[model samples]
Target: MTGFVVRRIGFYTFVAVVLAFFALPLLWLVTAPFTDTPTYEVKVPDFTPANFQAIVEHPYALGSLVNSIILAVGTAALVVLFASLAAYALSRVRLPGRDALLYALLLLSSIITGTAAMVPLFQLAVTVGLIDSQLGLILILTGGLLPAAIFMLKDFMDSTPKSYEESARVFGASPLQIVGHIVVPLVRPGLATIAVWALANVWGNFLMPYLLLSDVEKQPAAVIMYTLYTEGGQPNLRLLSTFGLLYSIPVVLMYLFVSKKYGFRFHGGIKR
Candidate 1:
């Protein structure tokens, strides 16, 4: 009894500490935007709108958010579309070395990240007239994200009972129709998962947009936030914290919306 009590106390204490460790930064993010002068150390925020006003006054602050939305949405759509098709095909059709090929592609994408291939990517962008273009940046992001996405979604497709597709086919459904009507509806959680993942990845991404895009107005919030620093290299905590607060809201809202709509739980392609 004594040992059990001690262990329970220790586990609760550890959990509490972990919660505080994460909660403090989040608490600061929520409160700092309302403080007149945001500081590094968290405190009771002196309620004020000065931080938001400062952000609005900045020339590109709001515009950067719009740019980020465009990029994130565009990238997510493309990644989800390609991943779904590829995942479906891979799940349904068994070709030689299929599993090996999928794992190899995922492995290669992980190893050759955007940073590692930036030089070649830049050269390709310049060759294809994608440099300084938002569409170009979106295309690059979509390419980088597709491999992992397709891999992640393949299991969801596999879990779907073949009886559903077989039934659809008996009713004269084409492969594309079966995918669009039956498979897609059944595997919605997977699609939602990929969409959210792709959006989050694109939302926080800085490197691809920074390397591919040169125009100030075209820069996303992740890249734009870097310019919030002071000239002497110190971070402008006020602007940084304020923008950080707003910068995080969209993704959070998106997550909440998706969670409410489809949820993240997977149950063998059926909601049961």
Candidate 2:
């Protein structure tokens, strides 16, 4: 009885510490937007929307959010479309060095990150007349993400029954029709997963948009938020916290919506 009680107490204590660690930041995020002169400490907000007004007053604050949405939506659409097609092809076709090809692409993507290739990327963009263009940034981000997205989606594609495709083929459905009408329906979960994942990646991405876009008007929220600091480097915490809370809402809502739609629950994979 003594050991059992001791272990229970220790477990609850650890859980409580973990909960507090996460809860504090969430608490700040929720309360700071409505706060007057927000601070780092978690306290009851004074309940003013002045922080929001202050953010609204900033020239590019709201506009940056629009740009962010464009980038995120564009990138996610491109990634999901290309990744699904590539994954389906890789899953169905037996090719020499197929797995090797996928792994090689993934490995290269990880090693040569956007930051590492920024100079070359910028030069290429300039050569192609895509510098400071949203379409250019979307294409760049899509390329960086495609390898990993395809790799992840391939497992889902493989898990789908090939019998469906065979039946569709018997009906004289074209390859594109089979993919659109047959394969895509069976892999809805994979599509949803990758779409949400891509949105989150592009939404919070700062460095890519920062380097690609030069005009302040063209900048996304991630880049524009950096300018919230005073010239002396003192952060405008009120504006910063408010904008962060607003900035986080779209992705959080997207995750919740997708999870709810797909019934994102798991059963035990490892048995005791």
Candidate 3:
């Protein structure tokens, strides 16, 4: 009894420590933005709105957020649309070497990451007159994201009941109609999951956007945040923490909205 008690105490203590470790950063993020002189350490904030005021006055600070939304939304919309279609087709239609093709694409995408393909992608963008264009960046990011999105969504498609689709077809439903009314509704959780994943990925992405978008007005929050540094390359913690807080809000709000809508728990093809 004593041994069990001691082990339980130790486990709880370890868990507390881990929770505190992760919570410290969040605590700092919430407090530091309101602090008069924000720093790395979390402390009682002086409760000033000066940091926010400073951010509002900075050129491109607010505009960069809009640009981020544009890029993230555009890329995610395309990814979800194309991935759903491709996954549905792949799931319903068996082709020669279908599994092999899916696996090959997934493997290639994983191995040749954005960094590895950066130079080629840039050159391709330039050749196609896509440089410094938001639409071009969206297309590039969508292509990079599609393989994995299709792979993940295909599992959801496969798990969906074929009987429902068959019932829809009996009503003389076209393929597009069946997909729109039946498949999409059933796989909404998966769609939401992919959307949130894609949003977060593109939201935090700095390298591709930085390389592709030369104009300051076209840069996203990720790239703009990089510029919030001192002349000597030291971080201005005040602006950084304040901008970080703002930068994090959209994704957090999106996650909360998605979680409330779909509950994030799924079994087979249904949201549980």
Candidate 4:
């Protein structure tokens, strides 16, 4: 009994410390937006609108917010469409070397590096006239995030009973019907999880947008935040902290929605 009690106490203490560690920076970030010091100092318990107002009232700030939203939504839709198709094909089909194919896909997922193909991808985008466009960023982000989304969706689809498709086929339903009417509805929650993950990645990523888009107005919030770091000839803490807080809301709201809707209890596995 004593050992069990001591273990439980230690676990709770560890959790509490971790929670504080993560929450502290966000807390400081949130409060920083509402108050500002005369220069580069941290203002404690001061309530003023200068920082938040700067982000809210600036034209470039609003444009960055719009670009971020468009990029996130576009990438999310593309991820779901392509990932669902790929997952369905991988899950429902039986073919030669299926195991090998899946293993290859899993390997591909492990090799993703945002910077590995940067130069070539940038050259291709420039060749295709996508340089400095919001669509270009969305396309790159979607392609970058697709592998993991497909892997997860495939596992979720495998968990669904095959009988669902068999039953639909008994009534003369086509493969498209089985997928659209039956499988999709069942795995909506899993797709939501994938969407949340994809959106977070695209929204928070700074490198691809920075390398691809040269127009400041078309850049996402992450790039804008980076600009706040470099464009002023030195680090500006007030603008950085303010934009950081502003940039976080959409992703944070998305996470909260997914947690509320899904409850974090996803059960699915791709079996051999």
TM-score of each: 0.94, 0.94, 0.96, 0.86
| Model 2 misplacement above 4 A | 265-272
- How would you encode candidate 3's per-residue C-alpha lDDT over 100-140 as one tens digit per residue? 99999999999999999999999999999999999999999
Candidate 1 total steric clashes:
0
RMSD to true structure for each model, in Å: 1.7, 3.5, 1.7, 3.8
Model 3 stretches with alpha carbons more than 4 Å out? 267-272
Q: In candidate 1, residue 33 scores what lDDT?
A: 86
Q: Local error of candidate 3 at 258, Å?
A: 1.3
For candidate 1, the 10 contiguous residues with the lowest summed lDDT are 263-272
Error of 2 at 50 (Å): 0.9
- Tell how far residue 130 is off in model 1, in angstroms: 0.2
> How well is each residue in 1-272 modelled by candidate 2, as lDDT tens digits?
99999999999999999999999999988997887878888888898988999889999999999999999999999999999999999999999999999999999999999899999999999999888999999999999999999998998888777777899899899999988988787788888888888998899899989988999999999999999998999989999998998899888888789778877642111122
| C-alpha lDDT score of every prediction, in listed order | 0.92, 0.90, 0.95, 0.81
By TM-score rank, best first, the candidates go 3, 2, 1, 4
Give the least accurate 10-residue stretch of model 2, judged by summed lDDT.
263-272
lDDT of 3 at 1: 100
CA error at residue 92 for candidate 1, angstroms: 1.5
